[model samples]
Structure formats: C-alpha cells, structure tokens
Target: MIQLKAGQNIPLTGDVVRFGAKAEAALDVCALVVAENLTVFSSEDVVFYNQFATAGVVLAADEVTITLAEVRADAKAVLLVVSADPIAFPGGAGLGPVTATLSEGDTVTAEFAATPTAGETALICLEVYRRGAGWKLRAVGQGYVGGLAVLLAAHGVDVDDEPAQSDPPPRPAARSGQGVPAMTGPVSGEASTVAGAPLEVGHGVERLWMVFEDAARSAAALVSAREYAAERLDHELSLAVSDPATRNTPAAEEARRVAQQRNDELIATAEHRHQQDTEQLMRELADADQALPPALASWDSPAWDKPAVSSDGIRLGELYAIDRGPLRIPYCVPVPLNRPLWIDTESTRAVAPVVGALLARLLAAAPQRQALVDIIDLTGAFSGFTGLLAPVLNGPLITDHADISARLQAMVDAAELAELAHTSGAFPAPTEHRVLLAADFPHGYQTADAQRIGALIMRGDVIGLSTVIVGTNESDSADTTVATLSQSCRHLPTDGGTTLFDPWTGSAWQLDLDLLPQEPERQARFMRTR
Candidate 1:
C-alpha cells in the first residue's frame, strides 16, 4: 500500500472502493457528497452513523464504502470524515493515530495517517473526487477542535439547520476532575490557527509559513499534552496513597499499582500520538522543502543542485529543533524586504559565506541588469564573493574609510533624488533594486557615518535600495547608533545562536544559517549571475 502525506493526491484504479479509518479510539466514520462548489445539496448528502447510507456512500462499521459509478451525477466528490465517538469516549479523547486506508475488496491500495494534535477531536481524513473520467484520492489531515458539526459546517452543511434527527449533540469536553487539561494551541479545521494576522496567500512563501505554523502548533500541543498527563498522574497517585489508615494494606497497594498502571498507559498513548504526529510533520517538511524554489531553498537543498533559478522571496535561513528530528522549516522574507538585515558576526559562523548565500538569493530574484550590488569590505572578508560577482557590481568594492563614507552619503543622496523624481513625475521610477553589503561594520564607521547608515536603513526600501550590514549583537554598546541599528533591523546571528519570532504565534525559532558551499566551483556556479 502507498502511504500519503497531507495535501498529496493520487488517482484511483478501481470503481468500487472502501475508505476505512481506524484509530485507537472508536471513530464515527462518515461521508459527504459534495457538489462542484463544495457544498452539500441536501441533508441526505451527509452520510454518518445516524444515516448509514446515501446514494453510493455507505458507512459500514469503521469504513465508508463508495460505488463511484453509482454516485450522483451532480456530485463532484466524496469527503471522508472521522470524529471521536462520543458514546465510547464520553469525557473527550483525542483522535490519535488515525490510519486511513483505501481498499479494493481485500487489497489495501493506499494509506495515510490523518493524525490530529492533542486538542483535536475531528478530522477530514481523505477525499475521493472526480478527475476527468476517473477518480482521485487526496490525503487531507485537516482537523477540527469543534468536532463533527464544525467539520460539516465548513463544507456548507449545518447540522442544526437540518432535521432534529440529523443534528448530533456537540462533543463533550473532559468533565471536571477527569484530569484532561484544557488543550493548548487549538488547531482549526478549515484555516490557520496562527494567533495574530491572517496569513496572506500566494508568493509561495506564505504557503511555507502556513505549513510552519502547522508544525509549530502540532509540536506545542504534543508538549502540552505530555506535561498535563504527567501532572494528572502525579495527582492521581497522591490521592490513591493518601489514606494513612490503609497505607500498608493490600487494598492501598493495589490502588497505587492501578494508578501507576493507568499513568503508564496514558503516557504510552501520548508517546504514540506524538510519534505519529512527528512523522507526518517530517514528511510535510521534507515535501515543502523540496518543492521550494531556488530563492527559498537552503544552501544544501536539491533546488540548488540544478541550474540557478529565480523566485518570489529570499531565503533567510531555517528554524531548527533537535526534538523535531530532521525537519527544517525554511524561513523567507518577501522580495522587496521591509527592513534592513543585520548579520551578527559574534553569534554566527563563516560570516562571509552566509553573506554570499544571501546576496546570491537577492541576485536570483531579478535579472543581472536589474540586480545592482555594491560591496564595502575593508577587512577583505568578502574578497572571494567580490571576484565571483565582479560582472554584476555597480561600482568597485569600497575598502577604505573615505570610500565607505562616500558610498553611504551617495546612497542616501540617491534615495532622496529617487523619492523626489517619483513624486514630481519628472523621471521614470527606478527600475533596478540596489543591494549594499558592508562587512565588519563599526571598524571604519564614525558618529556622522552612523546617521547616514540610519537614514539609508529607514528609507532605502522606498527607493529600491537594501542594506545588509555585518556587526556584533551588542544592542547596548557604547555606540548608541550601532546599538539602535542592532535593535531596529531584522537581525540574524551568524552561528544560529539566536531565534527569530514567527509573525503568527510569536514563537522563538532558532535561525539556521545558510552557508555557501565550500567548493569554489560550486560557489562560482551559484554566485555568477545567469
């Protein structure tokens, strides 16, 4: 059987298919007959435990059998859904490790682990939809904290609007003292659960961010569940051995043993759930990383294995977590960056190569003529990159204090001219984006130079100008301008010691530096503009 990850789809070969979902907890398997617009036509379209069968969709025990040939002509797809059976788990339980399968007779053709986080109670496991003259199945591991009703409502089916018999009671939460703590990082069924701003679609980067948000929520939920379970176990054990009168009696010993056994079972279940969630997330991360364009891909990503290509965003680095196995979430900012970038040399490794990788990304975003690069390296740290990108340089590399000040003043003056031209319509807007790379900062910068640096950092984005400065992470040093710049710009430590906060949840994720390849030939191939 072929295993599938979330958002993956495959074509089906047979006409008669059985969609089965099995979990450690009892599940109410159901199917929705959705039209082309993704809405159910009537109450008869929703086939659940109460309504066993409808048209070609049938709920038989743990599986939903569908005769594709017998389905309604207007129906575009059949959605396979599963929710925790309220009758079996009255006090609420997670739908853990839901193994969904597609079978033709006794042969399983495809499978997916539609695992939800700790708080989720319902999930849309799979979808068998029309693909021209045939059918295709998709692994959709979207979860719902609000249970079956919410899942149905997202598909335009309101159980409350239907007849009384169709309205299933809302799933119950764990009763008081049942030891199940309130769930953390509540994941939504239809959209992102990232707390702050609604994620913007397109640009490819937002899609990756959505996937990162999913991984974050799943990881946090697992941690929260594990901690809560352990605490609950401790409390239960304490209660079990509290009686001094029967402390040494056989009954007390049995109670303690039972408590410990129950705790172990809970922990075991939690571990299994975490393992499944992690595996699924790793698959997703790998898939997303592999699909990333050259601009967003890591230095070692297969995307760079091929010829150079351009994309919508620039890859800053990636988020690293030891507990998350091999999963690496690529971090990206949009093409026209909103702020300057400060590469902290104190905390990162191989500062020159890191700068090279970033410059390469900026170059890849636009054509050679449209990408203007200006390098200032008095320390000769970027000498290798200077030679590799000599063909695309706007001017000679500035290596002296006088040249450094001249370049900064020139950029600041150009920015003012560009803004005036834009407002007066006297000249066409600047067609090219300028990138400034200043290495070993504060070495040649004076008090007046800092003001010029600050001006460029503030208004450069408006005039197609960007700055990448290298310096220490000293936000409170003697140099007030340096300290303010340190605090203001989007900063990344060269060694990946510090963390970058996610816009959605404000979670701190360590930045994994994207170092340039060690081979000179490889570096040339990547750095030299195509």
Candidate 2:
C-alpha cells in the first residue's frame, strides 16, 4: 500500500480508476470529469449515482469507478469527491481523506481516511488529471461546511434551490467485481505542500479547524436521537484525541461526553412530547371523519336541492338536516363582492378543486370582463386549475414565500390606484375587480404574512377585491364557511344547512350553499379566449 499526502502527484498505470470509501460511514463518492479547457459538458458530467445522470462514471456500493476508455478523448482530468450526507453527516461533518494506490489487475483504488470531526460534511479528496500523455493523481484534502449538494453547486451544477430535507440521497448498488481492500486507519486533516514538506500552522489552518468545531456542535444539536448523538461523539472524540488542547486534558473529554449525553437525553424527551401531540390530533380527525355523512353520488345530485346561484352572487352547498319539513325555507348563502370568504375543512387532503370551481364561476359571471382572477397557492394545491384559468390569471402560480410577499405589495399598489380612480370618477376603475384565491393558509406563511393577508381581507370589499381563504384549521378573521368532505365530495350544513358565522353582524346563518355546475365545454372555451 502506498501512503499519499495532499498535493503529492503520482503517475497512473491503469485504465480503470476506483474511488471507494468505508461502507460504515455511508459516504457518497462523485467523479467530476472536466475538459482540458475547464468547462463541464453538462450536469451529468459530475456523476454520483443519484437522481442526476452519471456520464462516464460507474457506481458501486463502496466506490465509484471511472473508465478512462469511456471518458471523452478531449477530457483533461477527473476530480474525485467524497461527500458526507448533508442531512445526517453519518460519520461527522467531514469525510476522511482518500488515498490512491495501484492494485492487482491494473485497477487503482482511492481509499478515504477516517473522518476527523463530526462537523466536516464536504471534502474535495483528490484529482486525477492528464499530464502530457500520462495520467497523474494528486491528493487535495480540502474541507467544506456543507454536503455533496454544496460541493456540486460550487462546480456550477444547478441543484434545487429549496430548503434541504432530512432524507438522504439513494446509495449506490454494490459492485460485481472485487479488486482490492481499502487501507484501514485514521487519515490526517492537514494537507502537505507540493514540495513534500509538512504544512506549517497558519491562519488558514486555524480557521478551518474552527469551522469543523462549529459544524460538529451544530450537527450534534440537529438530530433528536441517541444513536445520532453517540455517533457524533465518537467522531468528535477521535479528532479531540489528536488535537493538542484536548489530547492531554482528560477533564475536557469527560466534560464533552457529559454534555453530549445530556443533549441526547433532552432531544429524546422532546420527541416523545411531540409524538403525544400528534396522536391527539389524529384522534380528533378520526372522530370528525366518522361524524360526516355519506359521500354524495355526484356534483349534480338532486339531493343538493337548494339553488346555489340566485340574484345574490354565489351560494354555498346545501345544509345538513335530521328531519324533512315542508314549511322549512331553503337558505341561499351569498359570497358578496366586497366581503372576503373563509372556508375551513376538517380533512387533511386539500380542497383546492372546490375553491377553483367557485372562482371559475365568479369570473365567468362577471360583467363585461370587469373582474380578473389571481391564485396564490403556496402548497401547490390548485395546480390542476392552471389550464382552466390560464387566460385570466394575473401572474404565474405562486409557490415561493418571497414571491407571495411581492404579490401582496403589488396588490397594495393596485389598492392605492383603485382609491384614486374611485375619487376622480374615472371612466373605468384603475384596478379591475379581482378575486384572489388563497389556499392552505398558515402552512408556509410567517406571522407578518398572515397579518398582511388579514388586512387585505378586512378592506377588500370597498376596493372591489375579494379573497377566498381556504385552510384545514379555523381562523378568527373574516366570515367563515365550515365544511367537511363526505365520500370525496363537499357537504354543507343540513338541519339549518352549513353554518355561516358573520363577523360583521355577529350573527350566524344556516344556509344551503349551491354547488356550481362543472361545465367542461365552458371551461375549455374560456381557456381559449379572455
């Protein structure tokens, strides 16, 4: 076995180069094949056997092998990367160093050093490049604060810009052929100079160690389980043992262990409490589901006898009733232009279809195209209606929180324009009457966002703008329409019908809301024109 230090270059003697890390650590090995001009052909050129396509690299359980024959003839070199799972950092924040050595049958193995700290997540281990007509290997032990995604992003790979989730990327399948066993031992974090001399302690070295320590503590706090904490402690102590500050100080080791243990215990306790709360919520949903009536046969069922559309705007669905009486008068609920409508459901599944149908009806019934429609769907619950409302939609479907805020600011500007138009008696209103459909409330919104939405709901009527906010939970703002789905169809109140509690009058009304007709022809026609 050959011991390779960082910056040490060696000539390659084989066509098959294998990059492998210990299986116990669950590290992801990636090979970045770059052209001599330093430009990547495509995202696939950086291969790591995940959702992204691998170009010239072949994946195996313990290592990723690069076949020089399959590589583009014009390619300059390959940068081998070993990345820790950003979510868990299985062995710690950093990936141990990787060594390249020639094995029997002309196969080369790149073995990683054991991780030094629990905090190092991303590392650029080594580079194999073309030197004139021969290939050479150079050990470059560079550490990064984030995971594989960050490393890939640095190299110009366009990854999803959303917040990282807890799930780790899929692991590679086991290799079919066996070549050689990796060298076993802890690898050094420090890299050697190109002159084959030990690197002197410098500001860069001190800063890198500080970054590792900070990442270690942060990773320890992120996980809420005993096993994760213990794993972090093991990796941390391994580095601590080699450090000058904690190597001889037995008391420091004991203190760190005690603190880590306490943190684990606290995390476990919090998780238990959260589990109990979730169980209680589940029980409530189950009871509500049971109390709901049988599902309706269709949207056009005669059982929904009450007229949803009359002289007054749109009506909610029919009411729930225990007994039928001839003298009982059917109530028609109106969603007026100036007033905001709030619909709350007990079901976990989204009810955006129902909201979309109502908006379509209102927009279709508008006078001389005086009204326009805008939908702010943070949860993507209303994506199905994108085709139907494409013509009248104010902007693209909003999925980002920042975009929602910007939309609201634009609405505020429109409101100011509407006020001027109303005062000056302009021939046409500065802002057309708009019906904003907001679904899945409070899920992605911050406290400030909720307040801004509430203000819009309060003053919408005078500005000829109306909002229909739909959510799973109840809210105190605006008049509310309480509903529950039975057999995947909307069911309104029966006895008096669904209850509509008016915040303005402080009075409750029992009315059967009308179900709008699902006209496919009308929808297609509207989609084609204004």
Candidate 3:
C-alpha cells in the first residue's frame, strides 16, 4: 500500500473503492459530491449518516464507498470527510489522530493520517477527484474550527435547522458563496501534477521526474486493466461451463461468445485510453525537455543551444517501451547523487561513450570551476573522453596503480575533511563538486585501496563528491568488501540490457543510454562551453 503524507496524492487503481476511517473515538464519516467549482449544486449531493447514499457514494457504519463508474457526470470530486462528535463532547474536542484507508475490494491500495488540532472539529481527510481520463486520491488534511456545519456551508451546502443525531456534527448554517482553496497551480504551461503528486512550479528537473512518474503510472494502469479484463473473461467462461446442465449447450456457447466480445471491447477501450494518456505525457515531456537548462536535456534538445546554467540533476537516459510504439520519457537522477553510479559491463569500448556522456552532463549541471573531475584509467579503458575533458581535469590522467591508490586516499581525506567541517564548523567547508571517474576497477587495486574506494562511494554525496566507476559485478566475490560496495551503487548496464525499475512503482523501464557524438569537433564544442 502507498502511504501518503499530508498534501500528497496518487492515482487510483479501480472504479469501486472503500474509504475507511479508524480512530480512538468513533468519528462521523461522509462524502461530498462537488462540481468543478468545488461547490455542491444541491444538498442531496452530500452523503452522510442522514443522507446515507447518493451519486454512487455510500456511507456505512465505518466506511464510505464510492463507485467511480456510476458517479454523476457533473461531479468533479468526492470529498471524504471525518468529523468529531459534537454531542459527545460539546466543547469542540479534537478527533486526535485518524487513519484513512483506501481499498479496492480486499486489498488496501493507499493510506493517509489526519491529525486535527485542539479546537478543530472536522477534517477533510481525502479528495477523490477526476484527473484527466482517470481519478486520483489526494491527502488533504484540511481542518475546520467551526464543526461540520461550517464544512457544509463552505462547500455551498444549505443547512437545515433541525436537531438530528444522524447529521454529522449537527448545526445549522446559511449557505456560503466561498469554495475550497485550489490545491494545485501551473508548472511550465500545464497543470502541476504528475500521477496525482503536486509539484513545485517552474522547476525543470522536478518536472522531468514528474513526467517520468506519470508515464510509469500510465503504463501500470494499462497493465492492470488488461489483466482485469482477461480475468473477468475467464471467470465468466468458467461460470458458463461450471453447471453440467449448461455445459456444451447452445446457451453456454452464447454466453462464452458474449463474454469474449465484452473482454475484447474492454481491452480495446483500455488500449485507446492508454494511448491518449501516453500522447499527452509525451507532449508534456517534450515541453519539459525544451525548458531544461542544458544539464537535464538530451544531447539534441534545444536547451543545449543556449548557455549552460547550474541545475539540480543530471539526465542519464530516456526510458521507452519496445512494444508500446514511440513513447519515450527522459529518466534523470538528482545530483549530489545519493548513490554511486556503476557503469557495469565487460566490454571496455561499450562503457566509454556512456562515461563521456555522463561527465559532460555532470559538468554542464554546475557553474564554472565549481565541478571538478579526476580520471583514473589503469588499462586505458576511458581514453576516449580524455581529450574532451582535458581542460577541466584536476590533474593529469593517472594510469599507474600506485597513482590510483594515492588518488583514492586523497578523495577519502577530502571527504573526511569536508564532512568534519560540515559538522564541527571549525574549518572552511569545501564548496566544489568533486567527481571521480575510475575505470577498470579491481584490476590492480589492493585491499586498502578498495577499502578507501568503498568509503568514498558511501559518503560521496555528503562530501559534495560523486563517483562514476566502470566495472562488472558479475565476477566479483560476493563475500568481499568490494562486492558489498559495488552492490551499494546504482548499476547501469553498458551491455544491451536496459531495464531499470522506477522508484515510485517499481515498474521496469527500458533506458536508452545517452551516447556522446563520435565527432571530435562536436565533443569539443560541448567542453568549450563549460
């Protein structure tokens, strides 16, 4: 299940969902059907203890159920709300901490916690709203000091002046003209949301990550719909043949045919919807790529035509599906990277281009003289990038084993000093972003060198340093320290294997590795700008 923090949101999976509330004391649960203006047109749209069901919303003893497929066409959102018992505690006591759960049948899909302040009597726990072709659930956690009457009046619901225990926090109020505050704004030129997660407006790297997340969600939804269709078809067919009286009969045959046709139609509809979603995301991706500040854009992106500026991330590659036609999303990771990057493969020639592209992107992400590089090639594996990076290197490229040891020791010391200064505030903290490009690792290194390398890999981000080590993990002994450190790094295969799992959904995505141009002039042109 996805645990949602306050102000976070995620895409819903199925049409029929249950929103349940659990608290120390019994709280009143309800749902309000609202329009795009976030106001209820009529009082009948409110589904609560008194009006138990309306517009596909059902409020039970402990939960509120919503059927997305049956919701009214004019409704834009369903607000899941929980209020404290005013009758039980008339002094406006808080609801303490309430946990809200969203489930599809028996499986819990997502959850959020709503903690009301001392005087707040009602809380808007979740918002199940229409987002594009699908729906999404956002953790609102918006509370009110004035009770359920204020909540209803805020959404334009007229209150009755009758005393009723069934009404949630019973109180009368005149209808209000105000609406709930909008929780989203624009990013770039479009709405600032990705897979229902709201984003900071105008940040290109965040936008890039958001687009990638959206594609992952879209892809996952397609797979789920297809599987559900197939399962439904199978279940219907089984029912048709289960009874011996109907087995092999004309009626059974007709049932099977109808079931198959419906299944095919569902699959087709799902595919069409998925295509629409993908196309929309692709357009957004293109817009985000064009706005990227040269650091997060692809090699051919228009952003590269402009001057390089400091960025918070580095674009490693593009993710695409081999079977899903032409949809491709840019994949990037933040820098001061959290994990060391391991360009893993056996072929020396295959890794050079990837390393070159990465170094170029990293250099472009930082301002002039702020990003430093140290290249160590024991077997001349990464000689191809030397000329391009010669002007910015910390020193001459070290090809000897002893020099590799000395370089690793120096980086370790730098990391230790920087980390110490950050905590102790006794010395001037290092401001430069150091990057180490070590190729042909574990070939000529001793145990002490490997240990030093391990320390650097583990604490690189904390010290404003990054490591892009090229080597194969397949042949390393699993029990060794080098193997342990290698496993800690983010492995990007240099061979033909391109599948990488997304952090949000763990969905496998095919990464199209960014390769630098082979022309010397083109490579030099990129370096000249830095």
Candidate 2 matches the true fold with a TM-score of 0.34
The 10 consecutive residues of candidate 1 with the worst lDDT sum are: 181-190
Candidate 1's residue-wise lDDT over 1-530, tens digit each? 87665544556888899988888887788999986445687889999988999998888876799999898876768989888744454444567788999998789988988667645678888889764467878776777766787678867786574321133322323323342222111121212223222223223565565456555544454454556668987887787678888778898778878877877786676556556656765776566567666777656668767765556567777776676445567766666554677887752235887898888888766553377788878777877767888777878988787888888888889888877777788757457778988777777777777788788877776566767888776567788877887666667765545444443233345667787776888888677565
Model 3 residue runs over 4 Å out of place are: 1-202, 243-249, 426-429, 458-463, 474-479
Q: Is candidate 1 or candidate 3 better by TM-score?
A: 3
- Local distance difference test, candidate 3: 0.72
Positional deviation of 14 in candidate 3, in angstroms? Answer: 21
lDDT of 2 by residue, 204-264 (tens): 2222222222222222222224445567677666665766776778776786777677656
Q: Of 2 and 3, which scores higher on lDDT?
A: 3
| Better candidate by TM-score, 2 or 3 | 3
TM-score: model 3 vs. ground truth: 0.65
In model 2, state the lDDT of residue 198: 20
Candidate 3 RMSD to the real structure = 14.1
Candidate ranking (lDDT, best to worst): 3, 1, 2
The best candidate in terms of TM-score: 3
lDDT of 3 by residue, 1-530 (tens): 97665544567889899998888788889999986446786999999888899978998877999999888865768999998756665665667788999998889988887677756667888889775557888776767666687788778788775323222332212122222111111221122223323332235556576566566656665665677789999999999999998788999999999999999998797677678877787777677666777777767777776776777678787788776547888766666655777887776566787888888888887765376789888778777658767667888898898888888898899888777876787755456778888788767777787789788876675566778878776335654878777866767765555456554434556777888777887787565335
